[model samples]
Target: MDLADDALRDRARRAGIAPDWTDVTGQARSVAPETLERLLALIGADEPAASVPPLVTGMVRQAIPLPSEAGTGAAVLVLESGERAEITVHPGDDGRCWVPPIDRPGYHRLQLHDREITLAVAPPRCFSLDEVARGGRMWGLAAQIYGLRRPGDGGIGDSRGIAELARAAGRAGADALALSPTHALFTAEPERFGPYSPSSRLFLNPLQADPAALFGQGRVAAAIRTAGVAEAMRRCEAAVLIDWPEAAQAKLALFRALFDGFDAAAEAGGGLAEDFAGFVRAGGALLQDHARFEALQAARLAADPADRDWRRWPAALRDPAGATVAAFAAAQDREIRFHLFLQWLADRAFAAAQAEARSAGLRIGLIADLAVGMDATGSHAWSRPSDVLGGASIGSPPDAFNADGQNWTLAAISPRAMVETGFAPFLDTLRATLRHAGGIRIDHVMGLARLWLVPDGMAPTEGAYLTYPAEDLLRLVALESHRHRA
Candidate 1:
């Protein structure tokens, strides 16, 4: 981020001190585009390797997969930790997790699980090891069948309903079924909307749980539903609104009753529990902790928002130091365990739905969609604040589609940092996304080439294009796409 443009800096200083009543906040002056281009060309040939190496060294782990998109940086890379790097790849034009961080400085001896591999790095650039195949066919469903058509099957469609949909898909000669983002929604809110923007992308939305999917299979008749449970479900589903609160409550209660069934049915060829266990393990302790925080906040808010929210609570309580907050956090943690269990259930349901599509013999099993950004206050931000910049949202300039630019207030990957570090977090996110999905559709696919980065308090017109390493990104994409075969 250093500048060789002395005159530009001088002009900026003058702009800052201008006595003319023009507020410079309205004026963000970098070099003129053409002049900047010329300067870049001139400096590129003459610039010392030392000057450019920092950007490469700044890579979190100094490694990323080669053959990523032709960005200025790595598309994705693997670190020694076997975790992801800050980079991302085009990944077969499908949305799925791509993995990264490579060794930097001299040679790196990597043992992926059991196999030993080696790599070397230079001052500003590093080498990468990529395993890529040409391409392969994929399969999956794109829609959550239950989400559509509010049948008379109470307000919510249970598992039976999903099965019926799967059967229907088979009949229709479709192979796969993709779903809208089914990530859990906040249970407390003014009808928390948008499932894609989740309270926690790692967990499932209990509202989507259909008791009929679990328990109602044997006992309950079609018309007569469980009194308390069904009634809550109806209330949750009745509104024109999404009804996250009523849905959460009804689903949670129904799950409590079904939990016994889940444990008992575990050995009966039902692998949902096991799948969920894998999911929990895959998320690692940090992900679990974040979900626990969501549970705590939701429960305390359920008990009382005034006592729970920082604005109304005592100073220390508002802070993590308050005794009451700790007690509440503990209680909520108990519920978090429940949430984790339910996550397994929902996940099983999701996977089952995918399998159902496969049995139907579709080309793709599940095609998931990834929004470009997430809410700043959400768990993703709370856990990885550095990866996600607050207050600053990701958006785009006005194009032919819409004259007014779009502001996806949700946090986006810090493109520069991500590319340099081989997109570690980005890869993790991709892996989680692609886990169940057979194919992924990255909304605003154009973002991979260049992002219109707008600093806060700036207009869309003032935004500039941040370059990415296109070739490397493409190579990583090819490698990961082969890995997923989508």
Candidate 2:
């Protein structure tokens, strides 16, 4: 390698970029210098020789590196239970603090002088099968949530279908049901239908909602006829492969009709009106941003078909919290509310499915699948731009199977931003996936350690590894797992 190449590689290495990696077959390979340059550029590293600062910085960012061995320090430790005490750490001691043993496990706070940091005190391990089953072996069924079909499912498999399937599985002695990622997908572009690439892991796919759950079967049938898509719906349901676009259109039409009816009933003080209001209130800003994005994308597409990607959207409208978005939401209130209503229905259906599974005697009723990352053009990235990296994609290094490597085209969370936010985005994602589910299966769990990040429009092999706060993330996961009994 020449001087410039060496410089670029050195800079990349300093930034936690892996220049060489061992593949699945244990074969080592070195990445090209050009790849490293491209990746560094995408991450806004224009100066190759520039120094990279510590990921966590600022006054509120000090961390007490919690090693197995203890250290001496005078600090005030605040337990999660609101109990506080002054303590002095001793060198070479076991993992015990100076205060009384913390029985309740959760994230607490530590104040040393003028600095304060988060202290995650977790149990030795998460709840295990050995404790739950008492040495008994348990078997369960894994299912694709969208592929579960039932009569009158409006061409797309839904949570109602899963609930019915759960009943059957329970009767056949199944104690658990693992499901595919039910993460939210693009409502505006149904062609981008992939369970692994979701718009937001925090929300459920509105398309997977069973209209019958909210609107009665009779009402759904009437709406289908009113929308004049009965034939299309029938064709979608009977097709061997899922005709996503056709099915999505038909289901969306039906949802629109359902929304109209719901709105009328809500105005007339219907029984579910208050519940819907409460759900909206609970969803808060996150739900509002998603709904607003969907509405804006729809409007933009209607005007110009090329306006699908939010990144290319007009400057003012791009920011979710900007005045432009606020004005748009104000003018398109009904449209935004419609999207919110869809989420409410989806949430109800999924919760009902989990309830059905548990009621049918399943111990681990619903196991949720959490995707590794979100699509770059999707709602989560659009809403939390600060939390996600721009102009970069999460991918894998070249392996024996594909010497070219793999590009997932998904945006990864920025470690620097994660630290600044105290891992709020990560915690929210975990909590959302755990909601209404007995357990969660993390896709690409290895990503917690390090991720291969490729520059936008570059080949997968043209990328480098970026380390994450794995220890902190694992501690949070363990705490959440114990709390959820997952």
lDDT to native, each model: 0.50, 0.80
Give the Cα error of residue 342 in candidate 2, in Å: 1.0
Candidate 1: TM-score?
0.63
lDDT of 2 by residue, 1-486 (tens): 789878877887776677787777797878788777766665555433312211211111222343322334787878778898886644435553332344567777766555566666666666676666788877789999767976677667999988888899889888789999899998988998899999888898989988788777899999988888899888888888888988899999999998888898898776689889999999999999999988998899899988888999888988999999999999999999999999999998888889999998788888999999999888988898888888888988777777889998888887656666777888889999998888889999998889998887788867778878787678778778888998
Scored by lDDT, the top model is 2
Any runs in candidate 2 off by more than 4 Å, and if so which? 1-10, 23-27, 41-76, 88-101, 111-115, 268-271
Q: What TM-score, over all chains together, does every model reach?
A: 0.63, 0.88
Off by over 4 Å in 1: 1-147, 150-163, 210-216, 219-227, 234-245, 259-279, 303-331, 416-422, 456-462, 468-474
Worst 10 residues of 1 by lDDT: 125-134
Give the candidate number with the greatest TM-score. 2
Model 2, CA-based lDDT: 0.80
Please count the clashing residue pairs in each candidate, in the order shown.
65, 0
Q: Please write out the lDDT profile of model 1 over residues 187-247, one tens digit for every residue.
A: 5552555755665554556556444543345543332333347776666557665455555
